[model samples]
Each structure stands twice: as structure tokens, then as C-alpha cells.
Target: MYQLKESRKLSNTEMKECLQISKSEFLEQINLECSGCISALKDFITLNRKDQFISIDQDIKLNDDLINSQRIFKTFAKLQSFGESIKSIISSIFKKTAPQNNKKRCQLHSLKQNPEINIQEHVHYICNEIVNQNEDCIIQDKEFDYHLQNYLKTKKFCPSCKENIQAALKHFKLQVPQPDCACSIICFIKYDHLKCEIHIPYDPILLNALLNKAQIQPFYQHASTKEDAQEELLICIGLLIKDRLSSLYRETQTQEIIKYIFYQQIGEIFKRRLENYSKMKGEHKSQLEELEQYLKKEVEQKDKQKKKRQLKKQKRKEQQLSFDGSVRANYLQESSRRSISPSNSEKNLLKSFGWQGSPSVSPQTRKELEFLQKEHLQEINNRRKQLREQTKQCWCEWCHHHKQK
Candidate 1:
């Protein structure tokens, strides 16, 4: 057993040699027909004693034949678990040893009948021929699958498929698939060469249903390269024709000319679209004109109101200034009269008493009188000048009165 444990750590060649020796020794000790069971015993003992050796002589007094049989069963079980073609052997073992329950019997039968199914068989078979033919065949397959799936989702036919369908439709008068409904995956595989007796027959319901499934709608042609130049020029010509027709229709009321123009424009639907767009633009322009007139009227009214407020404020300020000037003038006149009247009586008394008095006036009073008179005249002149300046600058009712004077 220790030797068997040691053999487990050996390389494959050394281990095989040790196993052969073990097998020979077991068959000799057993004294039974060597039914290749000794080889299984060697293998079993080696595996069981891999981490620790068993004292086979002391622990068990089993006959060599019994040990050999037990090892054979272990080997059979291991092979049944791992071998691809051992399902029948396992089923036989289970029928002889397993409990006689219906469920267990059914399970055993299932294991025997269906061995392990290989999921990769279909994938490998589909790709094997291509892989054998080309060195980079796997990469091409992956790219094709990617493009095919994208074509399915986008409803856009591959270039070759589209060209084939276009030619078929043109030559045979068969209807081409509408742009929205063209599922390249299904169409390429199934319907690229579909036949119909009509030329460009429209099928709105079927087309819309397929488009919904593919999650795509008709896309407008984009003029991104020289290849699209002819289409772009055609669109421009259509626009020009629509504009001329619209102008003529607006300028003339003749039914015959209008009918001719309508028929001519019908061949180019893009021209009709442009005409509708132009009419919408004209309606927007008329609305904008009305808004501009309303805004202009509001601005003029605001300006007039602003001017009226300014004139009213100017009139109030001028009235305050004139009232202030009049009060000042009246106060000055009263003060002068009081000063002169007192002096006049004093002078008359002095003259009748024959007293020689110096005009019966003090030098201070004369000086005060002179100062008051000068101040009054100066104030009057200043008020008149202020009124004249205000009248020149102001456009108010009070200032206008001053201006007329």
C-alpha cells in the first residue's frame, strides 16, 4: 500500500510500471483466474492511498480475491461516469444494483437512451466547410452574420440584393419592395425575386406592418456624394417648377392654365411639397406683418404718453418757481414801505419845529434803505431773466404764457 501511495506521485511512465508490478503481485497472491481485475486493484489502491498509506496487512484480513473484486467494481463505476460510450454499461449496473423504484428505473433508462447530446455539432457542421476552404474563413463568417443581423434590424437590403430587385422590377414590371418594408434578411433569402404583374403597386397595410416589425421608416435621400448629384439636381428643378406654377396660379384666375400647371406638377411630388411649404411661409409672413403693425402702434402710443408726462412735470416746476418769485417780491415791497414811511413823518416834524436836522434820517437807516432797494431791484431782474430762460426751454402751459408776453 505504501508503494502504491508512492507510485501515485510518479510520472505517467513510472506510475504505469509500478501499477504493472502491483497487478502481477496481486494476481499471484489471489490464486484466482486473473480476470484483469488486478489491474483495477492496483489503480484503486494507488488512488485511495495517494495522501496516506493504508496498513492493508494489519487493518483488513481480506482475501486477495475479495480485494480484487472490490477494486473491479470501483473501476467500472469510474469508467461509467466518464466514458462517452459507457451508458449501456452503467444502465446494466443500475438495473442489477439500484432500488426497484419506478422513478429510478426511468432515470436509468433515460441516461442509457440519450447519452450526452453535443450542442456544438450544428455550429461546427455549418462552419466546417468554409473553415477548410479559406484560411480566414472564421472571420468572414462572423462579419457576414453581423451584417446580416444589422440588415434584419434596419430593413435595408444589401447592395447586391437591392440591385437585383431593382433590375427585376424594372424589366419584368414587378413591384419593388417599398423602402420601409424591405427586410434584407427575409427578402434576400425569400423574396428578392418575388413576382407581381403590376408596376410599382402600393401596398400600404402590408408595407407598414413589415416596417413596424423591422423598426424602420422611409428615409429621405441625402445628397452627400457625386452619386447623389443627379437626384439633388432633379429636386432643385422640381422646386423651380413648383415656384413658377404657384406664381402663375396666384397671378392668373384662368381655370385652363391652372389645370395644365397642376397636371405638370403632379409628376414631381417633391415640387408639390415645396409649393405647400412656400404657402405656409407666406401665411407666416402675413401674421408677422400684423404683429409688426401692432407693435409699431403700441410704441407710438407710449412715446406720446411719455411726452405728455414730461410736459405736465415741466408745468408744475414752472408754477412753483413763479409762486416763489412773487412771494419774494411782495415781502420786499412791504419791508421798503415800512422803512420809508417812518422816516417821512420824522422829517416833517423836524421841519415844522424849525430844527435843523440832517434830513431826520440816521446814516444806518439810509444805508439800510439803499441796500433794500438794491436787493429788490436785483431780485426783480433775476426773476424776469429766469422766466425768459424757462419760456425758451419749456413746453408747458405756464411757460407758454410767459413766452407770449
Candidate 2:
């Protein structure tokens, strides 16, 4: 609990640095509590184990049921030969002497011609039932008879035949268990191309015991997510293989697990993650490219708008500095004509009319000059106002864009 709390406070990178661990190790430590991640890991490990074992034990490929059924058939054939040989030898001994012990031996070998179980009745259903049930599939007397007749066209099996069936069932149970076996084992054997019997590495009882252990029992928990399932898969494989190593292989020198299962089986548990990973990677790349293009184009458009705004500012400044030289010349000429000439007025006006010559321009010329100046000022004010508005608008747009980014 203390470790879990400490792990929570530290960032993943910080934790890794403190522990001096690789990225994979750091992530694995974090997901130890996550259920779905554990489940998925278990699946991969199961496939891997199957692959590793099958390469070495290719001789046994078929399911327990079919193999058991064949054994019954073979045993029945052997019993027939044994009965004949014993009878022939006993007949010669009887001819030599009236032997009570010989008669008893012949009596013991003789049977009432009634057989209880029929091997031919449900031959096909055996493998399917056993494999589907996993390592712990059990075929009790009642269940065996039911499947036998259910699959086969025949009616019922005799007592003599029943004995052979029971023996075969016992043998099958030793190889495969009655309950709690992982589905992966049955799948491995059922689909093998060779379809023959392979050496089972563990005893049925031992395998069951290993499976029931608390640490591994959780591997059978239902997975809500693919990652969760994967985590469980990896853990289950690791634990099982570790157990197998100490029990059967007896070698701790080797640290790596064999990955023959990856080559041999592409089961759903193993294949889903790979498919999802590839698909997600492709989607991520395409989306990233789209974002980059959009950002680049937006930057380019902002630059263009800035250049246009600067050009408008320069044009407004030039218009403000400009003056109408022709208008100014015309105004001066009008002013000169409107004024009284000094030469014409000074000779006679002082002696004859005693009128003083006015030096100021006329009221009409002064009013015209004031009106022209007002019009020029209004034009300049309008240009300045337009430039101010453009600059303000540009600044507001840029602020909004930055905020969004």
C-alpha cells in the first residue's frame, strides 16, 4: 500500500528515474491494478505457451474424446484375441487331464454375450465436447452414454462395451481434467494439422492445482477492455510457465520464454491487439498531418493580412502629407484682384477723395480660403479615422487568434 501511494504521487518519468527501470517496466508497474490490461496480457502468454510446447510435442494433436474413443475400440479388439488364445490353450489342457483349475480359468474368461456401452454410438461427439470443455472436461458414465447415443445412429451400448468405455474415460480424465481448464489448450490440439496425440507436460491434478491458485485464478476474470484482457493473458502465461518450469523443465538458468505459439497460432486473443495497434497508428499519422497543414496555412493567411494592413497605413500617411499647389496659386490671384491697387489710389484718392487704401484682402476671398481649408481638414480627418479603425480591427483579430491557439 505504501508503494502504491508513493507510485501515485510521482510522475511516470520520475518513478522510472527513481527505480532505474525501462519504459516497459514502468508502465507495467502502473497497470498492475488495472484489470483489463492484465486479462489481455494473459491471452498472449497462453498463445505463446501453446506455440512453445506444440513444436516439441507435435505427436499428440487430437482431442481427448476422440483419442479415448479410439482406445476403447482398440481395447475391445485386443480382448477378442485374448479370449481366443486362452480358449485354445485350455482345450488342449482339458484333453490331457480333467483339470478343475483349468475349467475355472475357462469359466472366468467366458462372458454372457451382453455388452453395455457402444463405442460406435457417439464417436464423433467426444473430441468436440472434451476440447470445448478445456483441460478439466469429465466424461462420467451417464454423460458418456448420453453423448454416445446422441452423436451415433445406434441405440445403446452393452455391459462388455461399457467396461472399455469407462477405462477410456478414466484415461482421458488423467490427460484432461473435469473442470477449470483454460480454453486455449483445447483450441491448440483441436486445430493442429497433424491431429495426433502429443505428450501433455503436466499431470491433470497438478495442472488443476496450479490453475486454482489465487494469483492465477484472477486471469479467468472477464475482461472489459482489450488492454485489460491482454494484461491478464500475460500474467496467466507467466505464472503457468513459471510453474511448469519448476515442476517439469526444472531449469532456472533460462530467463526468456519461447514464442513458438506466435508462429503457430493466430487466435483472436493474440491477433486483436496487433490489428488495433496498426489501425490506430495509421489514423494518428493522418490526423497529425491534417493538423500541421491547417496550422501552417493559418499562419500564412495572418501574414498576408498584416502586409495588407501596413500597405493601407502607408497610403493614408501619403494622402495626409499631400497639398494642392494649383488651388493655392488660384486663391492668391483672386486675393490680389479683390484688393485696391496702391498706385491707382495713392495719386488721386489722397487729394481728390481723401479715401485711405485698404491693405487687407476682400471678405469673399477670406471666406473661400477658410472653406477650402475646412474641406482639406475633413478629408485628412476621414483618412486618419479609417487608418485608426483598420489598425484597431487588425489588433483585435490577432488577439482573438492567439487566444484560440
Candidate 3:
């Protein structure tokens, strides 16, 4: 909130903290000091941060000296009542030195020599009787020829003499003649037998009809791109309009009409193109939708076929499991009966070794055989479980792939 008001006054404590001084020092330096003195002290401290106070003070003194000097000069001028005489004096000095700096002589030396004569009358007489009459300075009079030679000298003249010469030569300069009639245009036909050239007048209306017929002829169909064709057609039409206007109307109002017509034609072309684009877009959209529907139907059919295959595989697995179980039961029963009754070869070998009656199966041996059979059955069950798990993972992976597709 304190920061919100940039011009907020600081408290005495805040001021002391900012100044890094005790209360007594702050009071001595700030409270008792005049506002100007305080501001001056603050400026001195600010300038002294980079040890620049001495240089700044010297600069201030120099500026003060400059201002005082200007004041003294102004006062002195006022006391002297110079008014605007200083400018006149400076101009007079330049004028006095000008002739000495410039060494160029006058072209019309005769005119410069006879300064007391009527220069205007002399110039008028030379223009009318000599220049206009002969169209050149081919004078029969020796005195006039001498003056003309002086006028034609290869030397620059002073400003006054140059002015007189320019006045005299003004008659020879090409001047745009003012039209006697209001409309300032002059039309004429010229035939040059040397060039075998003849002028033929063309009918603007007939040319316009021919141009219109040519414009209507189909050419856009042969162009590479529609936009290029349109641009070319527009250029041709614009050129045609320009040519027609050149001989028909040459005004800004008609130019505006041509522009409006051009823009209208462009708008119509763009509108037709936009409508065609929209129609094409619609057709493409419909085609894409049909493709999507067809793809969906294919996916459904594939899923059904996969489900049928999985069901068949599962049925075959179940049947194989049941058959294996029955076969295992029969095998276990046969092994038990064989264990209870010794084989004939084993009985003969026992008899030869003086074994009496049927060899009694040991209880330990029976227990061991049963334990082995149980282990084999557990192994078979584990293998079947692993096969079932592998089938389940394969099915899951197929489903994931199908979903992605």
C-alpha cells in the first residue's frame, strides 16, 4: 500500500533509516536545514557516489561563466544601442571583400565599361535589330560586331551585368505558347514519303467489337491452372479496357468504373470457384464417410472370425485335457498293479536266489512310487497352466493391435 503512492512522504524514522544516520544526526542535517540546502546536500551526496562531484561542480561553474559572458555581451550591445547595425556591418564587410575574392571578368565587357548608358534600351535594340532580324550576331556594322564579340566572350560576368545579359537572351529561350482556344490540344497527320509511311484512321467502335469477340473466345481451358488462366484473362481484359479508354474516355471517373467492373468480375469468378470447391469438399467428405463405414464393417467381421477361431481352439484344448486326464488315470492304475505283483523275470531271478513265495513289495518302495507319480502329475498340471497363460496373452495382444488399427 505504501508503494502504491509514489509521492508519499517518509516518516522521520524512515528518513533516518534511508540516510543511515541516528535521530540526532538526521535532525541536525534535515529538520533544521532549509529545503534548498537539504536538496543541495542530497544532490552533492548523489553526485559524490562515483567521486564525480568535483567534475560536476567544475562543469556547473563553466556553464555559469558562459551564461554570465552572454549576459555581459547582451548588456553591452543594449548600452551601445547597436539595434540591427551589427548585421549591416557584417554584410558590408563581406561586400567590400567580394570583388577581391572573385577574379572573373564580365562576358559583355563593353556593357560593363559604359555603365552610365541606358543598359535596358541598348539590350532592347540589340534583341530587335540584331538578334531577331539576322537570327544570329552576323552584323555588318563594325561597332555593333565589336559589342557582340564582347557579349559572346568566354568569361563570367558580375551579377548585375549577368542579369542584363540574361534579359537580352530571354527572347531566344523556348517558351510554351499559350493556346488561343480553351482546349490546348492540336492534332494533325503527317505522311513521310522517305519512310513510305501513311496515316490510317481506325474506328474505335469496330475495334471494340473485334476485341470483345476475341475476349469471348475460349482460352482458359488450355491453361495449366485455373488461377493462372483467370489472371491472364484479367490482364487481357484490363489491357483492352485501357486501350478502349485511351481513344474513348481519359478521366478518373471512368477509371474508377473500370476498376469496379474488374473487381465485380473477379468476385463472380471467385464465387463460382468457391461454390465448386464446397461441392468437391462435400463429395470428398461423403466418400471418406463411406470408407470409414466399410472399414468398420471389415473390422467387425474380422473380430467375429477371430472369436470363432478362439472358441474352436479352446474346445480342442478342453477335449485334449480331458483325454490326457483319463489316460493318466489308467497309466497310474497299471503302474500300481505292477508294483504290487513282481514281473515274471524278476520272480525267476528271486527264486534262483532262493526267494520264497511272491516277492513282497516294500512299503517304502510303494510310498516312493506314489510320490514320484504325484510329482509328474503336478508337472503336467503346471505345463497345462503355462500353455493356457500363453494363449490368454496372445489373445490380449491381438485385441490391443486390433483396437489400434
Candidate 4:
């Protein structure tokens, strides 16, 4: 607690200068606070072995009176309970079997950290190839998968990988935990294309343990803004990864592991973005098809309406033609009747006047011929008036045009 207070009061440079240590040493000391606590707890348990065993080697026995009467024992019990709960949570979150179990390789694989090559250049080259390669050829080539498995189990590594991991650790202000204290094992694999299955070791460090008032101080003294909060979170993640890397990977392999993890994350992010884009593209295509179908239906309906209008127009034209033909035929028949009737009337008048035998005509015969002529002229005038009225009433465009002319 006093060390923590001193750390809070001093800057990193000041702490290093005062402690007569380098920056790396200072970072290592500060980051291992949780590990130190675990060590201290183990020591305490060992010291109290006369009371009862609290470790997994034996079943734990509790005495109510001893727990209640002794404050130290009560505190120890509570701490033990808290530790167990933390272990449970960690187990649930990282539910994969440890690499030591030698289980089926598939069962041990994690999608987060799988890589075929830990070297940056080679990994980049493969990614480029994947992008440029045709889909048909890429699917047929199964070599990528075999190389992917090799990265995880193979001990061989690029010479520069360790240097890269060390640099990363320095930049993040983190240190690898001592091998003896590492709770999880991580195997970093690098590859271009495969199911993402990078085995990221679970860090045993608990957030609650770090945040405990009786233990180490918080990562940030005060995260007042959103940016500060995000920065603090990043710092916490770095610390956890640092702890995991230190314990899981040998000094020689640390660089490869870190590189693999870095590239795996990038690949996962890219894959997710591609999946999202594909979904959007599919939706767009479906919308276009729907629009096309709707337009086609609309056009078909319009055509049907157009055809109906044309049929109605043709039917009306045929009816008009039939009506006009009947009217013309009736008019022609009436004209013929008038022409024949005039001749017949002339014949009748001559017969009535008795002009066949006598040249001289009587006054009565002349008067009768005058009356018959006047009657015939009146009948012809009436028929002409009726025909003119019927023509005026015709509303067809062809008939109206002729009437106007």
C-alpha cells in the first residue's frame, strides 16, 4: 500500500531515478503487483499450514467459531472465496483446455490467434496473394490450412520475432511474467487465410483483484473523460497480454507469438467487414430486383388497359360503320321509290285526263291533274325534311366532318 502511494505521487522517470533502476525494471515492478499479491497469499497459506490446507491439494475444512473469533482467519477465508470466484469467472470466459493436455488439435484451437507465419513480410505477402488470387484456385489449394496448424505446434521461428515482441512489450509499458507464475499458455500461429483460431492465452489477473482498495491502485488515478477511459482500458489490456505472454511463451518465441496475435486481429476485423459488406450487397440486389418486378407489372397493367381502350374504339368504329351503311341504304331506297313514283304518277295523271283518245281536255280533268301534282310535290318535300333532320343528329366524327363540309 505504501509503495502504491509512492507510485501515485511520483512520475515513471522519478520512480526509476529514485529506485536506481531502469525504465524496464520500473515497469516490470509496477505491472506485477497482482502477481506479488498472489505470492504473498501463498506464503501466508504456507505459514498457516498448521491450521488447515486451503489449496486444491486437499479438501478445505471450515470451523465457524475459528472464522468468527479470529479476524485474520476470517479475512483469509474471504480472500480465498474471492479468489475462487475469480478463477470460476476466468474458466468460464476462456473455456478451452490448456495446451499441456495434448487434446485433439481442433479442440484446442482458438479463432482469435491462429496464424500461418509469424514473420510480418511473409504474412503480408500471403494476404496480398489471397486478395489477388482467383476464388476458384484459392478454394482448391488446401496448403494454407496445413501451414496454419504448423505455426501453432512448430518450435521453429523467424530470428527477428523475439525482437519484435520485446519492442511491443516496451511500447505497451508491459513485461512478460516469470515462467513459474504463468497461469495460461498461448501458441501464436501466423497464416494468411483459414478459420481464425489464434490461441490467445487467458490471463489469470482479475480486474476486481487489481481494483481492490487493499491491493494495487487503479491503472489511472482519474479517467475523467471518454478518451481517458479508453486509454485506461487499453493500458489494462496491454498489462493482461504482457502477463500472458511472459508466462506462456519462451523468450525466443515471444516475438512470433506477438506478431501472430497482431496479424490475427487484423484478419478477424477484415473478415467481419467483408461479411457486413456482402450482406449489404445482397440487400441492395434484392431491392433492385423488387423494383424491376414492380415496374414490369406496372407496364403489363398499362398494356392491358391500352388494349382495352383500343378494342372499345374499334368496336365503336364497327358500330358506326354499320349504322352509316343502314342510313345510306335507307336513303337510296327512298330516292329510288321517289323516282319510280314520279313516273307512275305521270302515267296515272295521263290515264285520269283521258288524253289517250281525245286531244282536247275538259276543265275538270285539268283541275284534277293540278291537285295530284301538288299532292305529290308535298309528299316529296316532307320526306326531304325528315332526311335532313336525321343527318343533323349524327354525332360520329366521320359523319360530323362530312356534315360540316
Best by TM-score: 2
Please report, as a residue range, the 10-residue window in candidate 4 with the lowest summed lDDT. Answer: 184-193
Q: How far is each candidate from the true structure, as Cα RMSD in Å?
A: 44.9, 31.8, 39.9, 32.0
Worst 10 residues of 2 by lDDT: 250-259
lDDT of 4 at 10: 40
Q: Write the per-residue lDDT of candidate 3 for residues 56-133, one digit (tens) a residue.
A: 221211122212322423322342343244334223222232322222321112123212222222233333433333
lDDT of 4 by residue, 1-405 (tens): 332332344444432223232223322333122333333333333332222312211222222332222232233334334434433322432434344332222211332343322222222232243223321111112432344234323423243433333343233223333445534221111112244222222222222222221223354354444443333333333333333332333222333332233223222332233334445556777999999999999999999999999999999999999999998997766554543222456556677656463433344444566788888789899999999877767656567799889
Q: Given candidate 2, what's the lDDT at residue 315?
A: 89
**Candidate 1: regions farther than 4 A off:** 1-272, 338-405
TM-score of 2: 0.25
Residue 260 lDDT, candidate 3, scale 0-100: 31
Clashes of each: 0, 49, 0, 16
TM-score-based ranking: 2, 3, 4, 1
lDDT of 4: 0.39
Error of 4 at 342 (Å): 11
Better candidate by TM-score, 1 or 2? 2
Candidate 4 wrongly placed segments (more than 4 Å): 1-261, 338-405
